[model samples]
Target: MSLAVNPRFIPPAASTFVFDPDLVAEGRRESVPRYGDPIWSVLALTQNPSAPDDCIRWHWFSGTFRETFRFAAWTLVNHPLADQELARHGIAMRAKLSAGRIMRTVHQWSIFAAWLDERGITRLADLDTEGLADFAFYLAKTRGLSRNTASGHLTGLSRLHYYGRSFLPPSDRLVEPPWVAEGMDDYLPAASPLGGENSTEPITPATMGPLLVWALRFVEDYAEDILAAHDERRRLLNAADAADGPLLPDSGDALEAFLEGLEAEGLPVPVAARRGNPLAGAGIYLAAVTGTPRSKVRQVMRKPHWRTYTAQNHGPCHLGTPVNATLDAEPWHEPFTFDGIDKMVRHLATACFIVLSYLTGMRSGEILGLASGCCPDPEGPPAEAGRHLIYGRVFKIATDEYGNHDSAGVVREAPWVAVPQVVTSVRVLERLGGDGLLFAAEVHDKRQPERRSGRSLQLSTLNERIERFIEWVNTHAENRERESEMIPQDTHGRIGAGRFRRTLAWHIARRPGGLVALAVQYGHMRTLVSEGYGSRSRGGIHDLLDFETARSVAEHLSEVHEAIQDGEGISGPAARRLIHSAAQEHHRFGGIITSVRQARSLLADPNLNVFENKDTFLFCNYDRAKALCHPGRSGKYEAPSLDRCKLNCANIARTDTHARQLREAADSLVRQASSGLAPEPLADRMQERAQGLSELADQHDRKRVLAGMEGHL
Candidate 1:
């Protein structure tokens, strides 16, 4: 007997019961939903969408998935699963898979559907355990699929059959899979794990260090030109008479006319790339400046308007309130100008994307998803060290109680501890626009300005913008050194969204922990413990990078340990302790560490592995509530003052690579002191720091140090 439910028992379309109380009536949306509740209705929820080809082209689904695959006479029309993908049928499933994954399942289901129809298998009774086994064998042997792939296809077909059984006519009801593949892994072996580096490898120091220096220095270096030019353009616009000619922002069409005028006068104007928006290249400037994403840049520049901060003495100030022409006193309608002034706004947003993504080990999506006023208590100082935070949205898969991606994905309200640069970027964004999206999309339908909705820069658009932004940087650099160092280009275009988090993690992992600034020691173990106590959410690239950073540290330690075993010498006051640590805890069973447990135990000794003091360049192996460099030596295994590292600490160990750096430092300091450019006191301090490093290097045998240093770093 067929074991399928009756078609009449199935529930009707979910849209009939969807209750969205917050949806606004057309044309009069003066206000939108709050951050966490941003659900507007879509036409597809009510009716069948356009052809798969056309549907995938829309901004929402424009990923790499090719939906229009040809399979003879059949069309792969797999309907959307309600509680998955979107806030779809409201049945949010727990395991939120990737788009590529979802597409693969649907494709497999469609292929199975085609096979069944071709074989004239019209009813559930037509298929049995024997036929299912035959198909599985056919998939494995005839089609040359691995056994695991064949098993997965069988599982997918079973799921499709179960879902369709209730909806199909009684004659077509498909029973559950007759055979189960679970626990048969020994018979049908799983795919082997990948060896070597993952394809999306972390950015190396040689590739990323120069870019970091450029991004950190560029915006401020060009600040005078960027802002002065912005002010001049604003003045020109504000001074123009309405009756005499067109003004900026009043008509979207006026932008073209203004640029044409510049060109006619033999002046420079923003140039567009071939088949690309010339105006979008400026986003790179903003990405570098703020390290946010293209979306944020677009929102702020769409309409550059903002409230002004006035002098305290200027009675009854309303800095952030919307402009009330008569009551807004003056400077109220000032162009949040730099945005269009030589494409400054977009540049600033791009700068924000680049810096935050690179420095904080954050995903580009998380940084770009940030909204206005995302920073917490900016006017007030942080209550404790490492408490400064930035509020932003995370774009990874998240679940509601039902396990589906929540409507807002994840509204990251708890402040992500931020550095000062991020804080500054937040403040800059706040001043760019009023209470709408901070980084608004470029003016899309210039004729219908009033009807346009505020939008973020789409992923496809952002990728293009990133490329253009890189080109823009190359064009503006003073020389080839600066230009080539920006984002080494190729046919694949500029560095991508994935590089930032991994690169940051790689650099942080490589920090020489023992001692650069000798006075400070950090409670790095405490920090690691604290991180462990917090959420171990690895959905975002940023979260994954955190684990990757820890892994990198462990890997680096193993490399050093192996080198020492091969007859490398250690240096400094702690050399004996370091060698002893390396000698005793040799890792058990090597050759591509398949077990994580073994890897952890391999680097567990405090004497062998060092923790980094993020605040200062100190790696303390201090323990016993007695940090040698921490004042009074009074912190436990997890509580050292990273800011108090002193080069004289007994707990510190020096590597050969670090000795070379010390030599360079000592020579540089001597040269500076000899020259008239360095003052006496500053020169003395530099000499003292350099001398400390020299003493540590001098302790180790020069021949041994020189031989092993290359391997240490």
Candidate 2:
């Protein structure tokens, strides 16, 4: 009583026949009349499976018929089925339909097989041409398949279907479906093996071998020792936790990795400490000091506590305690060097500046503030050979109340005062005659005075020139092709003015080697970073003595007498009295005692070294050397009168020797750099310079010859 139909049905687009209701009814009627049977009832079930059993219905008993019916009319028209005879069988039902399901699955398979069918397609091969054609339509239109997909399906199905078809009889008569056209291939992107931004370019050994050797031998070996020491430090700290600070950059391996990482990130591996200072002792101390970043220790500490100037065999002196206050460079501008410079105007200024800066290290404003009268002849010839020989007893230069220059263009002048060092630098200028502007200030407006006005160059202008010189020297030294790589950017990637002072301090305090060695080391270090200047570690040590602690000690002494009975065996004041009394007979004890008392009381508590105490006492009437005229004035340390010195002062001899050595070292560095390059790399540049020199020589010869010829004529 129930009607069962195949569960699967294809969309109408896959049908071979474009069925019209009217044509189907007429066909059915004709078929029933000829057969003289109730074919309509059975045929009705084929037309409608849902039809009432009492009336007519359509039902597709065959999966092939159902699948073929799903395709669009257009697809059916193009792929006409060879199994058209199956429709005349009143649609196969039940037992016959079960066979049709196999036929349908085969039909789907045949469409794929048709691609490889060649001309020998057949029915016993399991599907006829019509079934294959119908299945092709079913796949394309019913399944919404694009030609590529259809082609791919066909290729895959052909492997299995064609192999099966090979066993069939050739008389089966299967016709292939028409070929489906395809478009260009789809673009399939390749998967990247290593994702993100990474370099594909390999690091070749030719370029990397030398770098490797430097790291392994120089850096790694040194670093291993540093690590061993660090381990020792940790053990010590664990024993006495209060002594050491937190570990820095952790271990040697960590430090190494940090350096490599920075280099990889395009930064130079900063040296932990420079050479001359032998960072071992100080570096270990600094590495253990807490409360600040390592880079900043120099600024706070003032580096070397005592400067050991051996020229005169007095001990060391505290750095901040000025040896000669009048000789301070603050009043003058920074000096410029002209040794290798050849530019006309720049060289002229540089020459003047070198004389001034080497002698004074002045601020530019102070140097330019000098008047003609500032360089009056010394009462006698200089006792020394330097810029210090020039007299600077005129008005001391200073910015007006506004300080420096203001937007209003008013530059107020201050009173003149003697700058002891200025006297020496001015001698070089005085040789040119003090007639013109010493350092002509560049400005525009009606306020301008005559050309020789006592005007000085603006500080900014002088700084610009200094920067230019630095650039030129660095460029020549580096042979750099790009400017950006010459100086490093800060952490935030910025450049600034602090570079010069820092570089100078580093050279004086840290870096390794003698002058030549330092220069060579600098060259190599800079080359590694592509910067033009010498690479030096800017590490420092703080002065050991503290003014506050000294003051506390002095203050504590005053109250100690109150804590003990007057008859106490050894009172603090009694000890002081004993020392002072003993000093009366012993010269060394005298100076030391006096200095200690002064440091304990009225005088500013100084970080006194032996030379400093000696100098202090010599200045204050003790005159242990019997050299000073008055207590601590010019007369105390001044040169002898010109008539007395006769240009033969021993001080002048020492000064000249030092100056000559310094200049020679600088020149040697230049020469060493000239020889550093390989012959091949420099051949062309050398030839070009030679050729230019030869042409000039030839021109000069021609001129001389012409002059002789004219005279003969």
Candidate 3:
């Protein structure tokens, strides 16, 4: 026998539920949500302070499901008993969950509720093992979601059960677990062995080179003219807005005076291109030249002489804002045409985005969240001569002032180190007005004043803008007959903001002393420290570096194997060891790395120290005891200093390619010595150096072994 409680005496869960103490203390009362509110505002709980209000709000349910599960959803997130039960099941309680995680939970629960409603089962107690199995099958088969995604939905349902059983009335409680006999794994698809590779593809060299070159050109060269035109257009628009009522009585006389001045100077009215033909708009051109309101210019254009002047002087006009940028000694762009200033400004902003994203390697959200003056010029510049830093918030691993998961992110202690190009890009963006954010949503569409929203630009919108930039680049290249300079389509389909960081990692890892590597090495030492600290974990850029390094190692080994097969001999002290190790690795790993762990493990092999030194025209088959690059250094060296490679180092290895490059260098030196331009002493030194290089090449040719002829060497 059970005691019956009166329904009238029971209090609503919303009235009794308590908010987190920290949140209540920190947040404004009006911003904080009551448990019973239809939309729970979690803006104060977000890690990104720049995140829009809509992004943090949790709208429980929409459409028909709202009426069916409104009370149930409220209880699941608010009731203390439900929260305690969820904590027991190893799920985070409402107060601990981040805004993003709570939103995902709500979305998943809504899907399940809608599915249950379709089957005419409304209450949690009505759900059973058979219905759960059918739902799993529907997620896996009908919906066709990936195994990981479907598993997430199932996990959400399991949490729902833990909370549902703690309901006030026993009739609404679920007595048994949702997955009675089987778990979520049993319903998921089989996992793949090679599944840990990052999905974001690196931008190929073909695309990245031209893309960056053009972006820099826009930022450094075309920026001045574009800004000038933008200002001129804005001034005209302001004048138009401020002029009240009708045209002034002197407006027609002013317009006629401007036309007379142009005629006297033998200058045609300013014409813009329209459908391959030059056409002049009297009102707009007169307004621009005479500094009058365009609204008044329209009234002046209605006069008879205005039509006669435009018809007689209708021709292409060369007048515009003067620009200093040039290509191949010719002006890169025609003088800025004020009529097309808006398009130019949009393209300028896109160019800045490309430069900042690719060069700095900041995550898209962090880059988009940048405010004005984030990277200010130094005041006196005495502390560090060349250190340029960008100060901004990092949301990925941020915490609040009280050491909790903060929705509003904290300022990063170590600012991002920027290159000169990145600094220039930021300065250019500053000139383009946004409320505070560098990439505000309304920055690109300033012509539409009514649409100003002061929100950070969305990633999806940036993706579209990137596509337009590419199209404009291709068209410009085609017009100039420089087809090779056009940015080609990447194999990874459309390039998005997320791929830049991975691409930067790939370039830095594979090309040790190339341009990108040098920039990263000097500008971002903090990244190196983070990489070292997180090397053991699957975080930071180190994992990407490992993957790319492993790939480079595998390709080198495969090339060595093929050279041995082709009867090409390797010459060095470690040649025999290199041959043996290369053959073993080729057979064992099959020239493929499946995951980051596998790449790290493969790179840990000490016997496989084949370092490609393209700058020195040889491979360093490095043995620390035998290396001469680190002169007078202590016990053991981790890697050969290829930049300081000695010509006579025992660790050096020479192949046919190395031999060819050596011969070419020797011949070039000989030519320089015989040219008679050098001093006598310098000429003698050049000849001696040439002789030594020729001997090394000859020695390699004589000592190289064929396949199965190691005994002779």
- Candidate with maximal TM-score: 3
Q: Candidate 1 vs candidate 2: which has greater lDDT?
A: 1
Give the alpha carbon lDDT tens digit for every residue of 1-713 in model 1.
11222236432232321222234335423322211221322221111111011111112211221111111101112233333322422221333333333445555655555566667765444677667666666676567776657666765655445444434444444455555333334324345342212334565555455545445443334333444555454444343322233223433333334434544665543322324443444433333233334444444445423101111111211112232222124321333333344455456556656666664555565665566777666445456435456666555554567554443456653446555565655555555544544444432112323323444444444455555666666664534344545555443335676666655544444442432112111134224323532354444333333344345445545555686766655665555555554444335332233333444444454554454443332245555344555455443333344456766676665556555666777788778877878889988888887787576556554534322353452
Candidate 2 local accuracy as lDDT?
0.29
Candidate achieving the largest lDDT: 3
Ten residues in sequence with the least summed lDDT for candidate 1? 45-54
lDDT of 2 by residue, 1-713 (tens): 11112123222321212323343344343222111121112232122211111211113213332222222211221222223322432222211121112224334444443443434432334565455455555566666666644554443333222222222223322333232122112211222232211111212223222222222221222222322333444443343344334445532333334334544565432212225442212322332333333333333233232112111122111111111211123311112111111132342343345334322323233345544455554464577533212222211221235232111121222212213323433443443334544554322111332321224544444555544544443363255333332332223221112222222222222221112111123222222221211222111100101122223233322322222122222211122332222222222222222222343332231211111011111001122233222224343332111111211111111111222333444445445446756375465565554454344334323322111122231
TM-score per prediction, in order, is: 0.59, 0.21, 0.76
Q: Residue 455 CA error for candidate 1 (Å)?
A: 4.2
Quote model 2's TM-score: 0.21
Model 1 residue 392 CA deviation (Å) reads 3.7
- How many backbone clashes are present in model 3? 6
Give the Cα-based TM-score of candidate 3 against the true structure: 0.76
Weakest ten-residue segment in model 2 by summed lDDT: 610-619
Error of 3 at 214 (Å): 1.0
